[model samples]
Target: MDIKFSGVTKIFEPDIIALEDIYLQVDKGEFVYLVGETGSGKTTLMRCITREVVPTRGQISVGGNLLRKINRFDLALFRRDIGVVFQSFLLLPNLTAFENVAFVLEVMGLPPKEISERVSEVLKLVGIWRRRNLYPPQLSGGEQQRLAIARAIVNGPSLLIADEPTGNLDTHTADEIMQLILGINAAGTTVLMATHNQYLVDTYRHRVVEIHRGRVVRDEEQGRYELNGGC
Candidate 1:
């Protein structure tokens, strides 16, 4: 899916600006990294894309659907095509790995056989198939992350939004998680990853969009974490 931000600006009450005159476009099948320091409006910009927080000014379109134009009835259907992975794996503690992924499909009213097949496929893809019976608390950090990833992709979303997906993991585990994400991107899922891992940003070498103080400072191809006097 493609994402376009046209002169997007966001401001909170009491005259606080979270984003200003931001213009960014991410094409389909592209993996772009959103980099900035803490409180730099990175999360707010992403929230605009998901329409969780409406922008104070300007417009955001995802996969050609204008966020402002989407009605309440269509919003749920629109979000089904978008997957979100958070820094904290928000898994259901009472549900096993298989049940977690299946829950998404079940809510969509898919047939039982198809849900089982799809859940199994994603679980194997994320390398958590053997532990499909384990609950969230029973799994290790990496395992839980894998389960989260599996659930996110099980719906075959066109766009994947990952906010600090590897933040809680160690270096080695982070690398493994990156590999899985990259593999997903390779298969034509547009990825928007907000992260602070400079090493991974430099090593992966994707397009980078850097924001500072609610403004876009840099957008570069094969970009690094640090730029000339930029974040």
Candidate 2:
């Protein structure tokens, strides 16, 4: 799932410019890290890709489809090809882990049997199969996050976007989640992760795109976590 942004700018009400003249591209099967400080347009950039918010100016293309031209109906269809995991682990407290993951496939109108199979597969892939019956409140922070990742990938999406997916966990658990994300990417899913963890960014040594004050500061192949330097 290739993503391209050309001269993109997003301005909120009054005078807030969330992004400015942004140009970026991520090829298929690439694991790209989007790193920045709080409110530095990292989340805004992800929102643009997901179409949660439209850019005030410029164009974005995902998997060859222009975002500006996609109608609401077509946009809904386009979103199914992309998966998103968030820092908050937005799982339903009333639903079991299996049910939460299966809900995505259910919304897509898949057959019950197929939904069950796919949900089971992804839960196991994320190492949470044994806890499928647990509810969100019953699971630990790491377990809940794993469940979130399972839900995100249950549809076999071509692209996966993660926004601070490890922000709530301890170092050990964060490392585990990072490993799972890497494994998912290894299985051919294009990954774009937004995070502030410098250690993970430096250790992984993947392509990094750094943003600051609504502008791209650095983009590097096998990049480290450098805020004050350019690649």
Candidate 3:
């Protein structure tokens, strides 16, 4: 899905501005990295795309749908086409890996047979089929993350958003997770990832959008993690 933000600004009451006149465009099937320090509005930007928060000013258009124009009744329908992953993993402790992945389909009211097939397919795709019967507490950090990815993609979303997905993993495990994410992108899902890991950003060399103090500072294709004169 293509995303465009034009003159978008988000403000919190009592004089806090989370974003200021931001302009960005992400084409379909592109993998874009949102790089910034803590509280630099990266997460807020992702939230805008997900419609968790509306822009305080200007407009945001996702796949040609104007966010400001979407009614409350259609919000859930709009979100179904987008997938999101967070640093926390956010898996239910009581559910097995397979069940966790299947839960999304169930919520969407898919047929039982179809849910089984999709859950199985995604579990194997993320290389965690063997652990499908294990609960989240039983899996390693990397394994839990893989299961999270499986759940995120099980519904076949056209756009995927990952916020600091590798923040808690070691170098090797982080690399593995990134590889899985890249593989998902290669299979034609547009990915927008928010991250602060310089090594991963430099090594992967994707398009990078840098935000600082609620404003976009730099945007570069095949970009490295460079603070330079800008933050």
- Each prediction's whole-model lDDT (CA): 0.91, 0.92, 0.91
TM-score against truth, every candidate: 0.96, 0.97, 0.96
Backbone clash count, each prediction separately: 0, 0, 0
Segments in model 3 whose C-alpha atoms lie over 4 Å from true places: 228-231
User: In lDDT terms, how accurate is model 2?
Assistant: 0.92
* Ranked candidates, highest TM-score first: 2, 1, 3
Model 2 lDDT tens row, 162-188:
999999789888999999999989989
**Candidates 2 and 3, the one with greater TM-score:** 2
Candidate 1: residue 10 lDDT (0-100): 90
Best candidate according to lDDT = 2
Model 1 over residues 81-149: C-alpha lDDT tens digits? 988887787999999999999999998889999999999999999999999998999999989988888
Pick the winner on lDDT between candidates 2 and 3: 2
